[model samples]
Target: MTTSSSDSTSAAASQPGRFRVGVQKFGSFLSGMIMPNIPALIAWGIVTAVVVNVSEFTEAGWEPTNALAGVIFPMIHYLLPILIAMQGGRLIYETRGAVVGAVAAVGVIVGSDHIIDQFNAALPAGEDQLGYVHMFIGAMLMGPLSAWLMKKLDAVWEGKIKPGFEMLVNMFSAGILGFLLLAVGFFVMAPPINWLMAALGTGVEWLIDNSLLPLTSVLIEPAKVFFLNNAINHGVLTPLGTQQADAQGSSILFLLEANPGPGLGLLLAFSVFGVGAAKATAPGAALIHFVGGIHEVYFPYVLMKPALLLAMVAGGMTGVTTNMLLGVGLQAPAAPGSIIAVYVQSLGGGVGNVVGVTFGWVLSAGVTFAVAAVILLSSRKRDMELGDQFSAAIAKTEAAKGKSSSALASLSAGVPSAAADRIRTIYFACDAGMGSSAMGASVLRNKLSAAGISDVYVTNKAISSLPGDADLVITQQTLTERARPKEPQAIHVSVNNFMNAPEYDEVVELVQQSGDDQAVAAGSEAPASSAEHASGTRTAVEPRVLTQDRIRIRAGSATQEEALREAQEILVSAGAVTGDYLQAMRDREATASTYMGSGLAIPHGTNEAKSSIKSSALSVVRYDGGVDWAGDQVRFVVGIAGVGDEHLQLLARIAELFSDESKVAQLEAAASEAELHALLSGVNDN
Candidate 1:
């Protein structure tokens, strides 16, 4: 988020008349908008109480209360963490799997705790075991995995499984997921979690004890308001919940389990400074701060003020450092937090742990705010200067969007539809009309614009509702498999990365092979209504060399520019010109050159503009020596294409040609035209 605000207001105006930033706010805000994780959070909460409180309630006289605590605590203990995890997933994934990831927090906690317990038991001299430190270490990893697992599971259950059977299918599907999840959590995550918790706990516990106690009133009180107030557990701490961590000042550590991490400084800066920095992300940031209590929004500010990073770094150290000095301890897991939990932990510190981290946060924030404010002001001035330039550019682009949306709805990779057949369309299908398909649509929108490709990309659920000649489903690999229609005139090909990863190669492949591969990618042996994989069924026709073919390409100087021009002209001469069809070459070149940077340049683009496989043209341009492309001198230009208008056999020839980099290299080095032609002839098109 950048530092630019539309409204200037009071800092103390809790009315959000200003703004706020920080991690707790961002995490919670994001996690909340995402799917609700109530079920998974509930399940994980059950696990935490059972495991953490099981030993505490084993007493004789206190058995009932302890047992009761055991039952309720784990479930509640899990809530904050689950919330934290779901928030983390939302920030990182932002696509469909956010709420669904709540289940993973359970596994992260369970697996990490078991491993940490083993280590705590092993520490020498019988020092009291550290608090639930394993949770923090595991929390980081949970977000990414939760995102992947949720996305993966979502794909399998909703995409591949038959409709009406979704619920039943998901039951078995979730089981498989659960088993795999448990296994990875146990074997893969456990060892690392144990080591990290041990490491982090060593420092974190020290902070909770001597350091946090002395500064409570200052740090904990304000932090409670600023951080995760929901986790403070204000009532539960009055009487110690049964846990060995209660013996000393350990309860302070227990409360940290539920409280939000430090975030006030970040919130203040983002709300004030980064006003218009990230418009889309800002609303989410605001929600996370106000309600969700995720404090990670501070991260982006940290990203901005890298020069003044020491302030935050110093603040965190002070938080951990002061806790160490205060000599407080806690038994409960460090949850994402609620206000009640923070209060109890502060109370548990007996005035010491509360005081230390308390002052530390203030001193930290005061120093951090000052630093962040200065940076924000500086950036604001810079932004203001750039505004006029940016505005004009935006307006120019905006005016150009004339009929772009309609054009998108009428996109075709081939030559703009013949004047007689003016309509060309593309459809995007996915399980949930809102999730992967939506993401794919966004990506394809960008791709189509860049490649000069226009096609109507529509979501699946919305597909049946509309009326049109639209078919040729563009969707995830699995959805096509699961939604197999009985009398399938609609043909589908596997799309990955929401169409972004399909990139030039995959997109061209999907376009050219659209109707033919409905089953093979599904791993279908061949359903009764099946068609062979598109690539395998095309008729092979001999490729005719149109120009007695002695092609020569060279990059003597200004490599990329020269290579691009030469290659484009060659392709155009070879019947491949269709309104800047060379755009892919431009796209890849701009993002990253295909020069491989090793005395070579491989310029390529989709030949979907053609009806025949006319993409089988190889113009080998060997510079006398080389040209500067990136850092290397490109000696060869390996032009590649996916053309369908040429002949069916040419597609196989092109694929075969690309497979042997060695042959391409040999051709690149060839001094004589005959040698390069011989090298191209070596690969037979079947």
Candidate 2:
């Protein structure tokens, strides 16, 4: 989920007497490693759910079909372990480590009583027993061990190995270390791990026999919100479910964490009764949660209102109870906790299973909504006016769009004065480092560049991979607790919208006014040109490309092209450009619509039309009645006039501004050039 970076500091992890931060960090890293393997895990589940019903083949007189199931099961059985081990090693030391981890896992795959007996004694008649190697267990153990061993060997040989023969030494070193770990896995680890596995299975069976399985949600629901769901689901529940499925043809364990009912119920309730952005964001999240199977979407909502955790717990227990009462289970795991995926996995379990799952979903949703509504209504704080929350939440919702919500109600609360300034390095973090967080980092990097702050290095990282040297940190509100424990010394800045100009402006001002108390960076020299004016203020200049005459508000036009033309005329009238640039703009539009989300569109000419430009300029045309641009209702059309690459930075700033709904709302409502110019003021290109 996307949230303002501003609300991060108040996360439970940031509070005292909660779970230790280190444990949370480990959970984040472990889950992150397992994230990429979910599809493969679900594929295995699908085959068991849809394709491996041997009885159906026998009834259809297609005995050969059963043979296909036999071939697939073995591969599926070993695939998860191999992949998990590979990912685990890759996380630690990259490709070489992954290779060593995979090689070492083979020993664990075959190390058990059956394999051991092959060398000791022959089996009696009718006793062709299978090996009891704990594949998942062994992989988890040997993967890291082997990777660590290989890393150590590399360190020892780093300078000793001949330069020309480095490849030979590195390859041989990894191979030898992996071989050693394989021996350890088979001879020293397998038997005890198998015993532990058996004990866990038996205890779980005991709980199921007594109808106490649903109580597990007391831990599961809370852990999930804390970003520990992957560890619990993949590392714990999945292995248990696989065992039950192997023995009894299905497992309720598979449905425990994957059930979508609880999250859906919470979202549905928030959509109806939630104050602020919660009401607007919840319904969409509900659909995504239940249908799209991205359960992560709802975690921030739960985190926002910790009381909602109870609602989730109650709903989870209800789903588990319903499944238990109906004697329903899935043949395989559901990849996403989505209803569609659950239904697909339920095929092997029959009509009863589908009905059970549906009933559980409905019951859980009903229960959760009731519980959540009661909590929201009863728990209003003295300082908080419910109506004010709604208003503030809406603006934040607009600013963040659909990414994340405020994790804390008091996002503007103060931090320690000693830690407020003098940050030399900035890190933008998120669940995955490749998406919005990366864009946020890029935005900040450009801002710092424009400010002539060459000493401050800006970078992006996954929440789990934050470096020790980071001086300032930024992340979504939901993940603040998860990230804070990693670097408590850094000046953490939480924000609702990475693209919000005000938020960037605030950070830039903080960085500009502060001294660098940390050691001087290697490139502490100032830039050749700075974004500061003679008045001694560092401001974003992207909006400077616009003159007062270029900002206009007009009635709706007949078509998208007419709107584009109207905006084009603003730049022409302002004497910002010359020649026929309209065709190139239209030509660019023909290739792809310029309608950026959040009720804004940016129309510009392609590189081929650069010759038509007389100067670099930006124009804003607001349509009060709104124009339809490629099916999207656009209220603001930003026309660009570029000479060479001068407009690219302006374009980036515009994209950032449009991403914040509240800002877009203000821009759309502006009546004069001053209001429009003020709104676009702090946004600029370097």
**Best of the candidates, lDDT:** 2
Tens digits of lDDT, candidate 1, 470-534: 34445443333232241133333344334233333434434444333221231123222111112
Regions of candidate 2 where Cα sits further than 4 Å from its true position: 1-20, 57-64, 113-134, 377-686
Model 2 per-residue lDDT tens digits across residues 585-677: 766565345554566666777546767778778788787887777556778777877654344444445655776667777787787878888
Model 2: per-residue Cα lDDT at residue 485: 61
- Candidate 1 vs. true structure, TM-score: 0.33
lDDT of each: 0.43, 0.66
Cα TM-score per model:
0.33, 0.60
Question: What's the alpha carbon RMSD for model 2?
Answer: 16.8
Best by TM-score: 2
lDDT of 1: 0.43
RMSD of 1: 22.6
